[model samples]
Target: MVSSSQPLASLIGRKILDQGGNAADAAVAVAAALAVTEPCSTGIGGDAFCLFYDAKSKTVKALNASGRCPEALTIEKLRSLGFEGDSVPNTSAHSVTVPGAAAGWVDTVDLFGSKRLSLAQILEPATELAERGFPVSELTAQFWKRGEQRIMNASPNGHEMLRHGKAAPAAGEIMKLPNMGKTFRALAEQGKAGFYEGRIAESIVKTLGDLGSTMTLDDLKNHSSTPVEPISIVYNDQLRVHECPPNGQGITALIALGILDSLQSKGKRAFLDAGVNSVSYLHTVIEALRLAFADSKFFVTDPEKVHVPVNELLSKEYLAKRAELIDPQNTKAVAHGSPANSSDTVYFSVVDKEGNACSFINSNYEGFGSAIVPEGCGFVLQNRGSNFNLDPNHPNALAPLKRPYHTIIPAMVTRMDGSLHISYGVMGGFMQPQGHVQVLLNMHHFGMTPQEALDTPRICIMPEEEGRSVVLVEEGIRPGVVEGLKALGHEIQVVTGLMRANFGRGQIIVRREDEESAGGHVLVAGCDPRCDGIAVAQF
Candidate 1:
C-alpha cells in the first residue's frame, strides 16, 4: 500500500510495488514523482528524512538526509552584508543550503531496498511522468500560485517554473518539466555522483554565487546523507512512537505525548472521558503542546554540533513534572523546562507486502525555497539555512558546514512486540509535530480509523512572537469550542476556507494483521482531504 500528497505520486509508488520492489524502493519513486508534479513544495533541490522499519530485523532506523551551510557562510558574512537580525531573509540566496534530497533517495534504497530493482528502474516512472507532462491538481496549483512572485523575483531561471515565463499554472493545466526529467536520468545512470559532482553541482554553485552567496562546488561535492538512530518514547505502553532524532522536530510530538500520558496516569485528567474536542480535552492538549514547544525551540539543533539531552527530556520523571503545570481551566505562559532539550512538502508512507514500512518527508523549505534555481536544473534551492539564529552563543547559530534546525520529519509507530503498526506523517512547516500528536491520539485514544484521524479538525500553536500566544483554529471545530478556548485567554485566530492549509497535508498507512487472510496482513490507508492525493493498495 502507498499513500502520498500527490495522486500520481501514490500510484507511481504502487507501481514500484507491483514491479516487486520493497517499501524503500517505492518510497524513492514517490519522492521523485512528487518533485515533478508538485515543484513548488519539493524537488531534488531540497532535503529529506525517512524512518524505515526493517521487518527482518524488527527494528526501525532513521535517515537524517538534511544538508549543511556552506563552509564559508557565517554570522560575520551576514553582518558585513548590513543585515542585523535574528534570521536571514527567507528567500535570500544567503539562505540556500546544499540540496540533500537526491543523495537521500539513493541512500535509502541502498540501505533497505530489495535487490530486485536497480536505481534506474526505481526512478524511471517519475522521469516518464515529468517528460510526458501531467495535469496540475487543484491544491498543487494553489500552492504553485503562491510561489509565482518569489520564483520570478528571486532567480533569473525562475521563469521556467511559471507558465511561459509569465504566470503560475491553473488547475488542470498540463505541465512538463523536461529539465527535471534530465536531472533524474542523470541520477539514475550515475548514482549520487550524478547530482553532487557534475554539471548539476556546478550550476548550483554558480546560481548562489551570482546572488552574493559564499557557496562553492566543494560544498555540494562533500555532501552525503547521515544515518542516525531513531528516537522514541513508548506512548502509554500501547505503542512506540518513533521519529528522526534532533535537528528535526519530531521529538516535539513524543514529548507532548509523554506529558499527556503522564497527566492521565497521575489521575489528574481522564483524556478519553473528557471526550474529543471538549473544553477539557482541548485545554489540556494546548497546554501540553505549549510546554513541549518551549523545550523544543531551545534544545533542538544539530546533535553533531551540540549536546541535546534526549534521554533526560523524555524521562518519565521529567514528563510527569511538566504535566504538573497544566491547569484544567486556563492557558499558561510556558518556557523551556530545565530537564532537557531536544515544510511545504510531501509526506508519504509506503508499506510493502513484507510489512517493511517507510515513512518519508521531503521539502523545499517555505515554498519555492530561496527561489534560487540553478541553470537548467528546474528546481529551487532550499531556504533551510534561514532556520539558523544569529545569536553567537546559541547552538543553532549560523556557522560554516553546520546544519540548522530542520522542520521536515517522518514518523512510524509499532506495537509493543516490535511489529510495524502505522507509517505516517503530516507536511507543513511548524505544524508537523502538532499534527503528529493530534492524528496519533485520534487513533490511539479516540478509536478513529485512518481516514477519521485525518478528517478531524486541528489546532496549531504558531511560533511565539513578541511573547504572545496565538493559535490558529481550523473551521471545522464547533464555534462553542472556539469560544471555550478564547474564554481561557488563549488568542484564537479562526482559519477558514483556503487558509486552513496551515493545518497540514497528512498521509497514513496502517498494517493490520488479519487472521482470516492467508498473507495475514491487511493494509489500511488514508490521504488528507486538504491535498489532491490518494492511497492505493497493490493486489
Candidate 2:
C-alpha cells in the first residue's frame, strides 16, 4: 500500500509495489512523483526525511537528509542585511539552502531497496508525468496561484514554474515541466553525482550566485544523507512511537505523548472524558503540546553544534515532572519543565507485502519555498533557512554549515513486540507535530480508524508571548467547543474554505495485527481528503 498528497504520486507508488518493489523503492517513487504533481509543496529542490522499518530486523532506522546553511552564510551577514534575530525574509537568497531531496532519494533507495530496482526504475513514473503534463489539483492550484501572485512574480525568473510562461495554472489545467523531466533523466543516468556534482548542481550554484547569494558549488557537493538511530518512547506501554532526533520536530510529538500518558497514569480523567472531538480531550492535548513546544523551542536544534540532552528529556522522571504542570479544570499556558527536547510538502507511508514500511516527508518549506526557480532548472529552492534565528547567542541561529530548526518529519508506531503498527505523517508549517499527537491518540486511545483520525477537526495553538495564546480551529469543530475553548482563555480563529488546509495534509497506514486474511495482515490506509491525495494497494 502507498499513500501521498497527490493521487498520481500515490498511484506511482502502488505501481512500483505492483512491480515487486519494496517499501523503500515505493517511497522513492512516490516522493519523486509528488515533486512532479505537487510542485507548490515539494520538488527536487528541497529536503527529505524518512523513517524506514526493516521488518526483517524488527528495527526502525531514521534518515536525516535535511540540508545545511551555505558555507558562507553567517549571522553577521544576515544581521547586516537587516534580518536581525529571527527576521530572515523568506524571499531572500540567504533563506535558500543546499537542497537534499535528490540525494536523500538516492540514499534511501541504496540503503533499503532491492537489487531488482534501480534509481531509474524508481523515478520512471515521475519522469513520465513531468514530461507529459498532469492536471493540477484544486488545493495545489490555490497554493500555486498564491506563489505566482505573491512571491514568484517579484522573484527573478521565478515565473518559470507558472504555466504558459505566465500565471499559475488553474485547477484541472494540464501543465508540463519538461526541464524537470530532463533533470530526472540525468539523475537516472548518473545517480547522486548527477544532482550534486554536474549540470543540476552547477545550475543551483549559478542560480543563487547570480541572485546576490554567497553559495558555492562546494556547499552543494558537500551535502550528504545520514543513517541515524530513530529516537523512540514507549507510549502507555501499549505502543512505542519513534521520531527523528533534533533538527526535525519529531521529538515534539513524542514529548506530547509522554506528557499525555503521564497525566492519564496519574488518574487524570480529562483524556477519557469523551471521544476524539471532545473539548476535554482537545484542551488537555493542546495544553500538553504547549508544554512540549516550550521545551522544544528552548532546546531543539542541530545536535551537531550544541549538546541536546535528549535522554534526559525523554526520561520518565522528567516527563512526570512536566505533566505535573497541567491543570485539568483550568487551562493556562504551561512552562518548560527544565527538560529539553526536539511543511508543506508530501507526507506519505508505504508498506509492502513483506511488512517493511517507510514513513517519508519532503518539503520546500513555507509555500513554494524561496520562490527562486532557477532559469531552466524547473524547480524552486527551499527557504528552510528562514527557520533559523538571527540571534548569535541562540542555538538555532544562522551559521555556516549549520542546519536550521526543521519542521518536516516522518513518524512510525510499533507494537510492544516490535512489530510495525502505523506509518504516518502530517505536512504543514507548524501544524505537523500537533497533527501527529492528535491523530495518534485518536487511533490508539480513542479507537478511530486511520480515516477517522485524519478526518477529525484539528486545532493548532499559535504561540504568542508568555501568558497569551492564539488557537486556530477548523470550522467543522462544534460551536460549543469553540466557546468552551475561548472561555478557557484561547483566542480562536475558526478557519474555513481553502484557509483551513493549513491544518495539514496527512497519510496513514495501519498494519493491523489482528487483521489476517487471504492477503495476510490487512493493511488499512487513508489519505487526507483536504488535499488531492489517495491510498492504494496492489492486492
Candidate 3:
C-alpha cells in the first residue's frame, strides 16, 4: 500500500506500510503528515469523515468526525445582537465552529490501528515545521497574495499573520506560526483533552472572545464526535456509497449513482460516448442534485436533534421518485442552493496488502478557515458556522451546539461479491457530490481506468440556479463532444490547460479482483501513472 499527493506524503505512507502497518495505520500517518505539508488545503483545525472496508469481516464502516457549532450559538442570541440568522456574515467571529479534526484523527487511529503511533509521533513533523516554518508553494503563494488584504481585515490575528502593512509573502518565503506549533504540541502530549478541555480550549475561547466572537469554553468542552451508518446503492452488481446521517452530503453521490444506473440499465450506451448523451447525463445529474438538495437543505440538520429518516432518503422508492424528475433528453437549469458549507478541503485514500482500505476527507471551511490564528497556534480555526442559516425556521439554522451542514464526504465501492473495489474522494466544496457521481460513471459505465476517469472533463450545475451552469471540458475531451453538449442547451465554459478548479482533486486506491492494490494521484494526471499511487507493493 502507498500514499499520493506530494512526494513526501507518498513516501510516508510507503514507510508506514513497509513498517508492517495496515492500510488504516498507513492512512493515519499520511494524513497527519499532509496536515502539515499541505496546510493550504487542510489542518487539525478542520473536521474529517472516513469510510473503511475490512476484507476479513466483509463489512464497511463509516466514521463521522465533523465539527459542531458552538453550543452557545442560538438564534435568539444572534437576533439580540441584531444579526440576521439567514444572513450571517462569512468572516465574523460568530462564524467559528468547534474544531473536530483533533478528535477525528485520534478516534480513527484508536478504532482501527494495530501499530498505532502516539499523537506526538504522528504530529512531530507538522509541529516541527510549524515551529520552524516551511517554504510556501507557488499555488499557495498566489492565494496568499490575492487573499492577504481580505484576510487582514478578517481578524486582528489575521492581520498579524498577513502582516497587513506589508506585501504578501513570496513563493519561497518561510511561513511560520509558533502559536500553531504550541497548539500541536499540547494536542500531541495530551490528545483530545489538550485541545478541548484544558489550556488549549481556554486559549481558543479567549482569543475568540477577544475578537468579539461568540464561541466559549463550554462549546469546546461539550463537543463530541458521533459515528453514522453509510448509505449505498447497487449499480451493475456493485455497491457505490458513502456515510449517511448528520452533516454530510454523501447522499448526493448516491443520488447521482442512481441516476446513472437507471440510464445504463435502459441501455443508454449512447451517453457513454463523448457527445449529446454525455451532456444529457450531466443535465440529469444536476437536476437530481437540485431536487435532492432541496430536501437536504430543508430536512438534513443535526441528526441528534432532527430525525432524518435516512432510510427514506436512501430507499429505492425515494431514489426512484427522484429519478423520475430527470429528463433523458434535455438539460435543466439549476441554482446554487443555499450555501450548505464552503471550505478548502483535501481527500486521500489507501489500500494495503491485507486487503484493508480507507477513504478519508478533511477540511477547514474556506482557506485559512476563519483566519483567526490563536497566539502560538499554527493552524486557523474552522468557519463551519457559516453553514448555519440565520433563519430560525430552517432545520440547519444556527442552534446551540448544532452542526452546520458539512460538505466533506468519503466514498467506497465494492463488487456484488463483497470484494473491495475502490477507496476514493473528491475535494471541493459543493463540487464533491458532483465529482463523486461523475467519477463513478466514468469508471463503471464508461470503463475508464481510475486515472483516466479522474482526468476526464467535468460539468457542475449551479446548486441554486435552474438552467444556467458552468461546464469544464478538459483538453482531452473530443472537440465534437463540447459542440454536442453546447447544442443540448448548456452554457459551456472552456478552461485552458487542465480543468482543476471546475472539477476536483480526486485521489483513489483500487483493490482489483485479484487482491492486488493500485493507487493514483489527482495532480500530474497526464504523466506516467500507476494504480498504487507512489506505493511499493509487498507480497
The model with the greatest TM-score is 1
Task: Name every residue pair that clashes in candidate 1.
Answer: none
In the range 1-539, model 3's lDDT, one tens digit per residue, is 55455444666666666766777766766776666656556777788888888879878888888877776667788888888637567687788888898888778777776555665766666667667766665655665576576556665566435422365667778766566677778877887888898877877888889877778888887777776677787875556555555678777677657655665666754555644235555556556666666666666677876676667876766676766666656666534353232326777777776678888777776766777766545566877788788877777778877788888888888877777877877777777787788777777666777777776766655434444555555455566657866776766666654224545567766665433424321211210121112433443
Q: Between candidates 1 and 3, which one is better according to TM-score?
A: 1
The C-alpha TM-scores of every prediction are 0.98, 0.96, 0.88
Q: How far is candidate 3 from the true structure (C-alpha RMSD, Å)?
A: 4.0
Candidate 1 has an lDDT of: 0.89
TM-score leaderboard ranking: 1, 2, 3
In the order shown, the candidates' Cα RMSDs to the true structure are: 2.2, 2.3, 4.0
Tell me the deviation in Å of residue 475 in model 3. Answer: 5.2
Count clashing residue pairs in model 1. 0
lDDT of each: 0.89, 0.85, 0.67
- Clashing residue pairs in candidate 2 (N, C-alpha, C atoms within 3 angstroms): 86-390
* Model 1 alpha-carbon drift over 4 Å, by segment: 336-343
